[model samples]
Target: MSVSINKITVLGSGVMGHGIAQVSAMAGYNVTLRDIEQSFLDKAMEKIRWSLNKLVEKQKLSQQDADKIFARITPVVDLKTALKGADLLIEAVPEDMNLKKKVYAEVDSFAEDKTLYASNTSTLPITDMAALTSRPERFIGLHFFNPPQLMPLVEVIPGAKSNAGMVDMAMDYCKKVGKQPVLCKKDVPGFIVNRVFIPLVHEAVYCMERDNASMTQIDSAVKFRMSFPMGIFELADYTGLDVIHKATVEMHMRDAKVIFPHPKIKQLFDEKNLGQKTGKGFYEYKGDKYERVNLTEQEAATYNPIKLLAVAANNAAWLITNGVCDRAELEKALKLGMGLKKELFATMQEFGPQNVVKTLQELAAKYGQFYQPDPYLVSYRA
Candidate 1:
């Protein structure tokens, strides 16, 4: 069956949904932004308006184009009303399985047979959620990054029972919406980005807890030394330590062998230090300004943070070499999803895989199992 997606139905009117709707509308597709209540729908539309106007101010878009995009989106409270003629339905609800299942059940009733159902879930398995829908074959994971309109990469995860054609259809729709799509062979906890990244961040936190480094030094080292936009600690604060902790815990529960659970994260969470969202994480935040109080110079230079980061890069490379996804796709996801610089890959390619393995092995002996190189790295040998 051929699916020509002209109209898109975006379920949930939160941050991701609103952003996805904006992108769909900008791409000239008729979009219906749906929520459970009229108030939520109204707020989402207002946010979309604000975002579009900001784009216009930045010269990325014109007022006329912004008006046209807004006109393309129709906010609705009723699920069936929004989904009436939708060729594709993208669900961007909260990351609760029961909530997602319920939403999928409701969508299953109203969505047309040809409509492709795509979940914007970050970590949840598409196969598990697709069981709630009548058309499991049409269900796939369209994992978009936060602020979807700006991010270019989307993970196109086809459930085990999904139709082969659905993958191609989803990829086509992704390209149509100006998104780069990558395929996941099977559902894995944290998909691609979060799996390796969460562990790396957690390990960084663990280093802090061990008194090996301070938050400021760690973040500064990463940003200046490694050329990352932010340090792991700073990123945790920016992304919310609670968020990373929750994701790590969930991923650990799903795959015990790979994910190492951090006790300090739970300790900090218990202490109510939930990062920048709460004004205090590894550092303190006063309104819009952030003050670095936890970082020390000795911790920053004495500890080899770059070596730890290499372990993460190796894990990502392992995922690619093991056929979980392609190397190009992994690189794209890191650059787009995790805000990693493109040159990070160039650095690795320049270092050569064998050299990277030797460096990682030395770090592993000093830092523990987290820094250990994957077997694939050892075997690659340039």
Candidate 2:
């Protein structure tokens, strides 16, 4: 039961949409990128051209091949024309559910019945949107990280009512576009990465505000001790403190116990200092581009990375035990999505699950029930 997706219609021309279109065109799929305005479409094309040129410069693709790939993308503003003949519709519109529902309604009327639908939503449940569409079984979530062209990980999530074979086909589509796909068996808020990652960021802030740890020390602990490629604060700033705050709020709305909006991030966001983009966040930046903050090895010893990892371990336990994903997929999601060199479960085991449980108990005492150790992590304690 394979759905042949030779022609792709990507609805939106923002960062994620343009990147999806570029990747699809690169994969030899004829792509139609539709937006509300011609200007948006033009800008997407310009970005695609720049990205394609960079690949050509690096010898990843020949100039001729790049040109052909660029030629394969058709940008339009007409809903009927854009949806016409599309075998797969990847919605990359804004994160608002209302806007998404509106787009889905339009697509339902315009798109072919055989066309499969996938949303690029990072947090929203696929099942909710799928139910609204004419074809619930064909709808799934294909979540791509920021800068989808470069990022390798794509979460292939199936709704509760999504067809089993379509889920498999979606995984194949991700591979066809040169991405590593991980299945998120359940469609919970934040899915896998955000489910765990958001709480980690919140705890890092908690360490700073509540524990009186400096951003430098917390970041040092994360990078040097935890072996994550980016420090917690650095990653937040790179992603924008405002963005993090919004995601935290959204996740909290779904599950108030485990996630909440942090005041520190909200303050930074309110100040209009949106990390690298605005040149100030937890730490200051000089320009529009990202520059790594310098921290000495001695600073890493000032804060324990285990405090951060404890929060992650608890969430990982819940995710695994609830069957959201297996140990392997959760590990891969953290590795590929979050860019961690170390395996999380392996690291937790090495650190001693009892120690993790102890840390979680401490955090729960101080921070409320959010840090309460899951039974799964506690089981390993004995």
Which residue pairs collide, candidate 1? 216-295
Worst 10 residues of 2 by lDDT: 257-266
- Which candidate tops TM-score? 2
My TM-score estimates for the predictions, one after another, are 0.89, 0.97
Q: Which 10 consecutive residues of model 1 have the lowest summed lDDT?
A: 291-300
Q: Tens digits of per-residue lDDT for model 1 on 240-300? A: 7777777877787787755666787777788889888799887778886665445444545
> Which prediction has the highest lDDT against the true structure?
2
What lDDT does model 2 reach? 0.88
Superposed by TM-score, candidate 2 places the C-alpha of residue 5 at a distance from the truth, in angstroms, of: 1.0
Q: Residue 355 lDDT in model 2? A: 87
Q: lDDT of each prediction vs. the true structure?
A: 0.79, 0.88
